[model samples]
Target: MEFSAADPGTVRPGGRTARVRAAVLRAAGDTLAERGFAHLDLADIARRAEVGRTTVYRRWGTVTGLVADLLADMAEQSLPRTETGSLLGDLKANARLVQRTLADPRQGALFKAVIAAATCESKTAAALHRFYDTRVKEWAPCVQQAVDRGEVPAGTDVHEVIRAVSAPLYYRLLTCGDGLDEAAADRAAEAAATAARAGVYVLG
Candidate 1:
């Protein structure tokens, strides 16, 4: 997944401001990955970024705001969905992308910290929801293509099918503590494809 600026209108591209934002965000990600959310301090983040404390405070306002912006950046930077001309292929690509991200030490730790924080923070929850929504929407077209090609029922809930492909991978990440291997990703894609073909995701 890739990461973007907080507010488009307020953001100017290709300047010292952009550099500062990038530095601060990188520092924030490092802090979260290394120490988790409970220890994320804006002042320390500013120090790590070599930015002024007042700049961090005036720009982000609070830890929650900083995190929310960070999530927005992540959503914006997410890779575009792959087009494989087949639902299973596209879904496997998506699953592998998710698996690779979850298997990386730094990225996995960063996501864990953010997810843990979202459990009790409304803003964080909303940001997390938006991030997933962006990803799902990016890949949902593959299921729709399958429907158009008569591979699945016309009434299939495309978004749900896309969601299903990554659900198990995330479950394993959060619960089973198993390695997110290519086999797991392929299994997730195959299961979701099978379910879609079987009309399991069809809407009444």
Candidate 2:
């Protein structure tokens, strides 16, 4: 079914399929945020999504499968990398994005719940890692652009540098010892920029 965003009921071959997939993803995200991975069940997701349990089982086969697909969808929907013509600006954009998401009460709790699940569940952990990999890949180009502009070393590990920019924010969120605020975001951006310029992120 063809599922066009413009058509409400195109009745194409993939129309219902796309709608059901979107519904399941939304339900999965809601359940993950609300109850964590332990309580996540395909049946519960089906009910929440208003899709049939048999359909969910037939398609996903397992909760882990559903989670994996959900992560993929999230990665697709994530914002693209920013290009502000400077390492500091690009890093600040990345940091601000992390801070905005981490600082929101609901989003913060949701991330904590998901990360906690990832720690014990191998499948969930892998999915979580892939999710970050996708996001990092999306933003890595910004760092590369900075390198092209001579803002950082040409041989700098762009992906690693971008990942470093968000590492401390995630650390603070998971630890619950400090707030992930604008000031914290600024600090992270500055530190990552300075370190990258100093060859800290360059490979031998």
Candidate 3:
């Protein structure tokens, strides 16, 4: 099943399998955050998760598979999009969520590890793309609603507009050492809203 950032309605089987998956994924996240993707090892992850190496190797097969599953689980567990009845408000909410996630020491490190791996790993890159696709789809409706309310022009690319709200925040994380703050999130929101209203995101 394709994992989604919005509630994808947990198709994962429950009970022991779910418990093992959760434990494994959590351990994988911790390893990525602390050691980077280059150092990720299925045996190490199994040890960290307190599961048998045979189970991890049998289930995931490779480090790439484990990382892909971890990202999928993350997308599944991600918070749902916030609806605030206004484009700016919705964008701000989205931006703030991104900021908070990237600003956290562990989460930020984990993302960095995945991104680093994605640079050289096609499979990891594809999984990363899917993760963002799911997140964008989750928030795209907010911009559509804004269009319906006449806040943006017809044919505006709502998904791109929503993505714009988070772009600068992500850029800052990758490029600068500055602290991510609420002000930055609000500014990102305002800029995206202004750009959308000015037809910048309007599809040609």
Of the candidates shown, which would achieve the greatest lDDT relative to the real structure?
Answer: 3
Q: How does candidate 1 score on lDDT? A: 0.83
How does each model score on TM-score?
A: 0.92, 0.89, 0.93
**RMSD for each of the candidates:** 3.5, 5.6, 3.4
Off by over 4 Å in 2: 1-14
Off by over 4 Å in 3: 1-14
Q: Write the per-residue lDDT of candidate 2 for residues 1-204, one digit (tens) a residue.
A: 000011111232367788898888778777777788788899999999899999999999998888878766666666666678888998898898888777766556666777888788888789878888888888888888888888888799998998899988988988873677889988989999999999899987
Error of 3 at 132 (Å): 0.4
**Which lDDT tens digits does candidate 3 get at residues 50-144?**
99999999999999998888888778677888889999998988988888888878887888899889999999999988888878888899899
**Cα deviation in Å at residue 1, candidate 3?**
22
Worst 10 residues of 2 by lDDT: 1-10
Cα RMSD (Å) between model 3 and the true structure? 3.4
TM-score of 3: 0.93
lDDT of each candidate versus the true structure: 0.83, 0.79, 0.84
Better of 1 and 2 by lDDT: 1
How much RMSD separates candidate 2 from the native structure? 5.6
